[model samples]
Target: MEFTAALREERLVAIVRGRDPEASFRTVMTLVEEGVPLVEVALSGADALDVIARARRELGTEAWLGAGAVLTAGDAQRARDAGANLLAAPALGPGVAESVRQGVPVLAGVSTAREVAAADRAGAAALTLLPGSVGGPAYLRALRAPFPDLPFVPVGRVDTERAGEYLRSGAMAVGVGAPLIGDAADGGDLGDLRKRAARFKAVCA
Candidate 1:
């Protein structure tokens, strides 16, 4: 499925960032096994590219694996080459354009109306609302008033409750990090992670 369609249909993006390469890769595999349709490995994480490559090799070409925190053209190129079918950035930058040029869907970050318009014009597949909890659902509703057609995936500090609120308020999806991931990426507990993932899927459903 297309990235945007997966976002809308799944309504959640699981973000994995860990200090251990092996742990991070396991965390990603856990999420995939639990049916989290979209997974993004932050490039800031240790050995993120290797994790992406390994996941791609294991999951094959059909899994919705993505690279997050992409900041430059080089980051975009490396991520694509590493087998990420999607790329996400904290803001609209060189990575967005490079991902577009590479024929990969990008989730461009935005906070203001102007930035939203700019990302849209740049051909971002979706707008990622950074620090999404700060403005809350009301802020998302306000942004949607003028750009109703744009796909927005609110990220940061989003819990199961807030995830539903954002979706109801017009966000196409919600990108969850620590809340959903917890310390699973850090080798905390896969059992707990599975429980949380199931809860998120239930809430989003």
Candidate 2:
């Protein structure tokens, strides 16, 4: 499914932005193996696009692989070239709207009221709030107050357990990384996180 539409459909978006490419793959594959419908690979470094391609090939159509942490239109275009079906940015990066117009789903990140307004003006289908630690889901709820149609996805320093709270507090989706994927990501850890993914699913169940 398209990225924005998928968010609208209520599937959790698992973000894979680790300290390195290997960790990112192992972490994301964990969720893919567990039947996660979508995954995000933040374009944090040069190897990020390669990681997205590998994940797409490894998981095939079983999961939708995308890229995040984009800071420019060129980055978004590169993500698409690397097999990213969806594009995300730390904020409304330059040409973000055009990338989405080209068929890449855009989950543009926003941090403040002004940024949110900017993203809306840019036609972002969804917004990813960083440092979810600041206000977490509570702040997200407040952001959605006026723009009830807007989708706010909280990310950063969040764990599997907090996912339930994010959803309960009115977030459209949550982006989980280290807290759930962990620092020791590998096949074994993937197995464990898969179980945790089940727990996340149960919470929304």
Candidate 3:
């Protein structure tokens, strides 16, 4: 499947963001091995591009690997060159334009209709509501009302317990960070990541 198609189909994206690149890579491998469909590595961490590239090399073309927290065209291009199929940003920025130019699917973070419209105008594949736990599923429902046609992926603080609620409330998919990846960066149990990924996948289903 294509990037956007798999995103919408899976209805869940495992956000791999940790300070330790090796831990993050190991956690991502666990998720993939346990059947988690989509994964994105945030660029804020060290050796992020390396993580993306490694994921592509290890998981092969069937994997839906992407880059997150992208803000600039250069960042988007770097992600693209590293084999990122999708680009996600905290807000509408030059990265979205760059993704469009590079034919990469994008998920722009947004909180309001104005930002949603702006992201749409910039040609985003979907809109991810940052701080999703602040307003929870209710906020997604309200925001989704106006733009019924657009795909919405709610990120930030989303866990397994609430994944279904967000999807039930009309979000196209949900992006999970620490809750999904666990504390792998701090040498926490990597085995738990598989369980978490399975639970998340079940809920998103």
Candidate 4:
């Protein structure tokens, strides 16, 4: 499916930030098996590019693959070359412009209206409220009230139970990391991960 349509339909994105390439790949595969339409491999840890490449080759068009924690122009280009259909960053910066220039859709992280406006100026495809749990559903609702037309995705501290609240509060989607993908170092069970993915899908649905 098209990235935007998948985002709209699934209303959930599994963010992979694990350091182990094998574990990350397994997590993504399990998410795919469980019906997740979008997955993001964050660059905050090692082997992110490799994991993204693996997911791209393995899942092909089955899922919308993206790279997160993109903080520089070089990072943006590298992610694009590595087969990331989209890019996400913690804030609006020159890297976002680079991603746009490279024809990669991007979600810019923003916490306030002013930042949201800046992201709009930068031509972001959407906005992600970082550390979303801090603000909770009420915070997202308040932010969306002013920019109801722009898509808003909440990342950080968003669990399965809170996913529904965020969506109902007007989030275009909710990004869950460790809680959804589980810890790679711990070698979490794939069966359990599938079950969590299904639960998340049902809640977001």
- Alpha-carbon local distance difference test for all models: 0.94, 0.74, 0.86, 0.85
Instruction: Please give, for residues 1-205, the per-residue lDDT of candidate 4 as tens digits.
Output: 6666778888998898876788888887778778886888888767888888888998775458889999999999888888888899899887799988887789999999999999988888888898797899999889888888888999987888889899988988999987787774237688888888888989899
Give the worst 10-residue stretch by lDDT in candidate 4: 179-188
- What is the Cα-based TM-score of model 3? 0.95
Best by TM-score: 1
Off by over 4 Å in 2: 19-23, 184-188
Q: What is the lDDT of candidate 3?
A: 0.86
Candidate 1 lDDT trough over 10 residues, lowest sum: 1-10
Candidate 2 residue lDDT tens string, 1-205:
5556677564477777666678677777777777666777877643788888888888775467878887777887788888887777776767486676676668787888888888888878788887778887778888888777778888887676777788887777787766656553433456667777787666645
Distance (Å) between predicted and true CA of 94, model 3?
0.6
Error of 4 at 23 (Å): 0.7
Please say which candidate is ahead in lDDT: 1 or 3.
1
For candidate 3, lDDT tens digit of each residue in 54-128?
A: 888998876788899999999999999998888898888898899988888899999888999999998898899
Better of 1 and 4 by TM-score: 1
